[model samples]
Target: MLATGHADLVSVFLGSGTLTVAGQSDVDRKATRFDPARTTVNVTDAALRPAPGSPAYDFLGVPAGTPIHVIPQTFQPGVLWAGWNTEAIPRGALAGDSVDITLNQARGPGLVEVYLTGLDGPERVWSSRNPGPRTLRTAVPTHAHANWAFTAPGVYELEFVASATAASGAPLVSAPVRYVIVVGPLAAAPTRTTLDVAETVGGLRLTGRVSGGPAHLDGGVPTGWMEFHRHYADRDDVVDHVAVDGGSAVLPVPDEPDALGYTARFVPAFHDLVAPSESPTVANPRAPPGAIVVGVRDRYTAGDTITATALVTPAQPDHTISWWTRKGSTTTPRGTTGVLTITATTDLDGAELGYDLIDTKGNAVASARAVPLRVSPAPPPTSTSPTTGPTVGPSTTTTSGPGAPPTTTTEPCVATEVTRTVRPGEVEVVTDGHFDYGPVIEGGTLTARVKDDRQGTPTWRDPSGYVFHLTDTARTTPPAGSGYDFLGSGPVWTIPLTQRPGIPWIGWNTQHPSVLGAVTGDVTMTLESVNGPGKLAVYGQDPFGGVGDRYFGTVEGFPRSTAIPAGRSGVHVHGVWAFTAPGSYSVTFAFTTTANGRPLTTKSTLAFHIGPGDPAAARPASTVVDQVGRTPSGQECALGTRGLADTGASGDVLFGLIVAATLLIPLGLLLTNVATLAAARRRR
Candidate 1:
């Protein structure tokens, strides 16, 4: 008696009503016997597995000829499990026991329900409701399979429970299980990347390329982006992202010192397709040495101080340079790194000074050749002693020779002799004679005289304000009537004298035959009107002007007695004179002024000769005067008729000879007749 497809037997009974053996013994007595048995089947836990090489199992009490099926399933250790199902054998059941087993549980598809936690945002990688559970069963045997359809790449913790009921009406519930799923490649990062450091003006540039990634849609090029990071001593700087064009990227490194560390990474845009990678640590290299320039003076004098300096490009910190001389024999440590100072001595003349750049270990990194020093000798000292002498004074002398009458001669002025030395770039002014020589011109009785019988000191002022004094020996007395009375004047000033352009001297003669009275021309001189506003007056002492009287000439439109106003500074003024007689004339020029309330006065004398006179009286013009030609005394003069007849001894001799000749002619006739009578008598 099987119940319900022979899965379980409710009861089994056997009876023959008091057994046949007992009926033979006691037929009369009524006898009865009964026997009963019960059987049941149950389902046990179901296990999901791989096709082969999976965990194997043995069946106990499974009846022979029972239908058992082996099914294929997909299995992922942390994701899902699917395989064949089995029923539990009854306890104490023999291998041949009468029991039935059936695998009637619905064999649907296998699925994994995944919930992602601990993420920055919400992300759903897989869900069963969208496409329903995947079929875990397959017809093939001993084959590997996978269903990797992850929407995003990240870590996910999965909570899943599998539930099913066996054909025997038994229910089975699997404990809640957890699985950690890393959906994408293990670590999709940059790889085989390189960091090349290049130096720039103010910093460094780092460039690199990454190769590993999904082939780009356009070609086999890598499609992704890269990030660069520079690690400094104190901090890390992250550069901007750059697209991986042609599988390469470049970035500018932050301005920092050399030997700094940095990193580069290649990250794929499709996180699921390619794994990211990072490059090994790379460092920047040191920069090359910069240009060095040394500055030193070329020449100096002995006992002078010398200084030198060196300028280095791209000035580095803690860098030092040493100063040396003569192949490092003479070393002088500089107070500063690049500056040097030394006292120049005679021994150091024509020597070389050198320099070298050194590192912390005192090793020379760069060097410069030595520069030569030229030392000259110091100059000599100058003398400042004052000159002593009476430069100008009047002198009178009387001399008498044998057979000659004594005669007295007077000179208006005579100068003393003195010597001086002048140095370069310097001018010396020397004054002589009495300082109180007053009234340059005076008159007494028939003779006009100079006060104190001495001329004032002669001074010259150059354009550069250098003042010089004329030597007494430079003075000269002029011949009579040249209209120049002063001595120690003329071009002797040494002051730069230039003629005024376009202004000709009116009534003055610059042509040849410059004899004083021969051509009846005017004597002219130019005066530089630089010494500020002043008065210039010309006083003339002539024989025609009687005692205590004199003639005054006009200068620059101003009369001799009146002061001539000085023109603008640097202009030239002309002083002109016209004399009538051929004799020596004394002319005095007095210049007076006040500068800033300081009184000043300058007096000079000019002397000139008029005609060719007695050679004994021929005196050269004043050295200060610019004479155009010979004086009147030096010219040739013709004799007139009256002067020829007055030739004393020669005229008497000619007249006496003529009278003797006239008487001799008559006497010769008378004597000739007598001689003829004598001759006739001598012949008889």
Candidate 2:
């Protein structure tokens, strides 16, 4: 597996009542959150060859002037800085408004210590040299950096957990999360692998060879199986494993029409002594051109001006470029240009900017995917004027008849929420990208979100991105005993339980990394509402056409919910989603789960263009706005003063710490998690 050669900065934040860890390097413009079990954080030899001799630094338990690896509390030019923050935990959300961080275990070659330099002196938070569990308590909305000291160069695994009492009188605790830190020089020798693919009469043949280090003490060739991964539109799937024979492996796979690309990785038998290697992606004949690139800003505020541009590989100057806006099967042509410039208004929020490459005949040959826009509200105005006089507030009084209780009307708080819309061509056409609901830590709140998983990478997309076009291929009559009487004995458009050509394969997978790692209970996705030309129903069926789990339906007296088993890594489910008539269907769904002892629920509206009707005319289930935050509660009620500049979570210190996929998803991406794939190839 790949080790984080140099994480210039690492931030551990409170996510969904759990510790969310992320790291950034000089080479990485944005910090990325990774699964500690699957990643290794590397502390290079540049840390500290000679430890600080100051008496104040002696608490590190290492001899002064001796060799030590130190991730400093303050930023150093070439070394990494590890820190913690509680900014994602809102004020008054926890009992006593504080969170407890505990270092449950620290295993390393030598002593391991973490401390902070306070105004009084050095305050030690963790010391493996000492005995009991070391814990630190900090108020919510806190962010601080600390010094990490290691006595010897080796691999260290630090286990951490966060705990608190929720304001609702429940105990909240995080799962034990592990962080692997490798203090270099590394012990293992690296290796490399190369792959080649050829077409045979039977199918496609793959050959791979491993070389580099004679990683064994006996100078023996590496012996292990080679794992082959199939690349789809957005993710990679393991297809086959071939054991190495004479340092090389060959595997033959049946020719599949939809196959896009292939990649291979070498798994060393002496895994600990020799690092595994991976081969670059080998594109198939059907693989789309990778040279179509798009560029745009990450985010914008309302009323701000922005520009989005696209670049073609061969410089298609003669090709006509047309800009378009898409929302639920509706496409609005803007103009013909390679670049689009416009004012970012609130209405444009959640919308997308895209370009179509049209041939001389006016037919679109290639299209750049729609990139979603994130537009936040402008900062509230500053109040610094001196008041001429103290303003008096008006007193309210309630009056009612003597026999009746006071009759009063209380105005319910109305918070605006947003769930963006997406039409055809907005997202690349894909056969599979497991869809599910997972927790997302954003804006200081842990909220459930509809996520799209491409391989092991999970991304939170707006409801609009969940749209699917139900074409004639999905048209079929409901089978008897299918428990789908809601379709009224008429032909319906259905996304099948099995994969079919020219249509999307929609499914829910609770095994997504985020959901499987953080959640401890069953997840329920319920249909809250639906708006369309006709009714809708969702249910699972066996290959024999026997119906199984009935999830949701718009017909009266039909089930409207389905539950996924808790913490099960195999809960990948696909079902038939049937629609009664042709038109755009806006289906509202809510995913609920109890995580960290707190009950959480997130809602979103998915758009479905059923048949040949004008899908653009279909209205959304509910309106979406940007004057509101994307938190689970979507609460906008607030009255507060602007605080001084500090390293809060919202600042660059922690803001980039939240894990998210890039807004611009390249079409026909042929890539894999080479590091993860290598580790996964190890023999059992």
Candidate 3:
């Protein structure tokens, strides 16, 4: 016999209840409250049940009421169900309308008893009465129906008889059902029930598993009447949906949020018997408040380390908790509450930490706060401190206190959408997760690409923290195509190919895609197998459009081979765009006569205009730089404005451009004298 009843109800916030899943959904969350492992009943044993005061607490640490069936009179004096009755029901059946009893079976029959108990207090009670012993004939010819019942509500106990005998009437133990009669205005309509959720560090799991004892009630246990739903206060995207598995519930650890919380929605909550509100407003807050306090014991300089105590507490200890540092969204906490020492590193521009609590039933509550994890600027080098008062000297150890170990909280780089401030001649970049740099550059296109073919396309990872772009020419519109172009993005596809077999270069020539990837392959070997043994192969794509199996050549500097032996590794190939005169250039790779398949070829890709490398050889003898921008010294950069430098020597200077000023005057004077002398001779 099992105990069945209701507990405190809970108000839920559905939108905030959603979570990110990295595993199976049918998984059960092991509750720390009661062990389901010990509840196994040996149906064959005459005496069966949990020993009194045993670790198993009334079906998951719950308080249940009355026995559903009992056996007062037994024919035999032998074995009973191998267990004791823990109910508070009366042992005898002399009761009137105030007591009720029942033994029901639509499909099968089991021995049962009915009785009652008196209350000691809200937490304790007493019962030792019976309605007499009776035998439940399981092997009887007509074992069709054994439905039993009694009249009224209080002063009675209910029990299920086991190992009952036909002769001498052996006796068994019993448990009482606690039934309180309601007569006040605040009394509920009997349809309302409290939903108290458990808080956890890992998250919640609500399976909608609805179970109750007295499985066969006056009209069979009302497992069907009960239903479960979610209430997401922050996530209002959807109103409701059907929960699964016998009203058993499952909630889980949510994914990192985009903001503080999701939109709100009111989904139906679950309950066996719905009780009315005691008060008109709302039930006693089923959930407790959560809090986290942060305080510093010492102040550390910028780029240094410091720490503070993180104290977290809740009204009741029903929820789980965890700590989290800021990322792009509100996330899980760092090892949930204790002392969290944060460092004063330069990366802590906008750091945050949060705590999450979960209930045994998988309900959750959370709280978080944001703070600046900034590094204090370093102290000035020289002490202006009254030199007159005392002789001053430079000291590196500037801080004083009871020395403590350094503390550092996680400090991530700016988020993907972050924008770094820029300078005229400098470009901005993210050095790491902790640094934003200002670097000087010339006219060079700096392109970058990052990939992890194994993990696939990831939204959480992007170049959000570092941004590089050119500044427009303040107010002057260009005469046309004279500036620069920036290309920054590419497709990072996550192709799960560990078990993927090599597809035919062309689909038609091969067998209908033989499933041989998991088999032995030349290079795709299995070194480990936690999840299906699979790996990513780093193979270069053919530059041409046609597909074919071909022999790719070896590195030019390495020993050449027509076909690589099994398990052979690949070598690196470096390419350069030559600065010689612009002409059609063709390069080739050789695998000797031993080469087997088709020639490894790629079409012409990279194309650009190339002028002279020397100033004198440049087609134009002179190109002027007038509105040249320069640093405060007005000195031209050695690399020049466009990263183009002027030839260093006289021979390298562009032709026809006058260099020495002394050689110019004589030539001008000679031309002027010739004109004057010609005019005088003509006049004579």
Which window of ten consecutive residues has the lowest lDDT sum in model 1? 19-28
lDDT of 3 by residue, 1-684 (tens): 112110000000001222110100000110011211111111112222222232222311212332222111110011111111101111121111011111211111222222111011011111121222222211100001011111121112222212212122332222212221111111111322223334355443222333332322322222233232322222212212334234233444232222111111112221222221110111112222334434332244775645443333324455555556675664534564354655565554455544545557766655544443544667778853110000001111110111221122222111011123322222112111111010001122111111101111100111111121111100111112211001002111111101111100000000000101011112111112111111111122111111112222121222222222111111111111111122211122221111122122111111111221221121111111111212233332111112122211121111101111011121111100000000001100
Looking at model 3, residue 40 earns an lDDT score of: 17
Candidate 2 per-residue C-alpha lDDT over 650-683 given as tens digits, one digit per residue, 9 for 90 to 100: 2221111122222224445422111000111111
Which residue ranges in model 1 land beyond 4 Å of their true spot? 1-293, 303-305, 327-336, 381-684
lDDT at 580, model 1 = 30
Number of the top-ranking candidate, with lDDT as the measure: 2
Each prediction's whole-model lDDT (CA): 0.29, 0.54, 0.20
How many collisions per candidate?
31, 1, 127
Worst 10 residues of 3 by lDDT: 504-513
User: Which model, 1 or 2, shows the larger lDDT?
Assistant: 2
**How should the candidates be ordered by TM-score, best one leading?**
2, 1, 3
Error of 3 at 9 (Å): 33
Q: Model 2 TM-score?
A: 0.32
* Stretches of candidate 2 exceeding 4 Å from the true structure: 1-34, 52-59, 186-239, 242-265, 268-274, 277-684
